[model samples]
Target: MEKLRLYIQIHQLKEQGFKIAAIARKLEISRNTVYKFLGMSFEEATDWVVSLGRRRRKLDRYQDHIVYWLR
Candidate 1:
């Protein structure tokens, strides 16, 4: 589902007196995800979604090698 949709659903469910676990089950998402989004305003949710999209590590593909080197 789209981030905005998920955010709206979370808030709506919460307003309707649904618990985090119930929201998770009803939405087929994880409880952690429901918890993460539960208190965010629409603007905050949008920024979070955009930030997720912008998450591009400089060496994501070499993460395992980096870890091995560090060890």
Candidate 2:
């Protein structure tokens, strides 16, 4: 949801004539990230963000051990 909001905000700022560099500064994100997001369509961005949440992390195998340690 946060990623979706960022995508919308980036497009909105672009529509308002904000340059990529300016948008990066305003959003406190890297210029490359701004360019990457701008290059993607809204639907593409949504799919990418959703896929990210479903991707496996390297630490997944340690989940049980980590939980036990914390407890």
Q: Report the number of the highest-lDDT candidate.
A: 2
Where is model 2 more than 4 Å wrong at Cα? none
Q: Write the per-residue lDDT of candidate 1 for residues 3-67, one digit (tens) a residue.
A: 89989988999999998899999999999999888767788988888898779888998999999
Model 1 collision count: 0
List candidate 1 segments past 4 Å from native.
Answer: 57-71
Q: What clash count goes with each model?
A: 0, 0
lDDT of 2 at 3: 90
Q: Which tens-of-lDDT digit does each residue in 1-71 have in candidate 2?
A: 99989989999999999999999999999999899999999889989999999999999999999999999
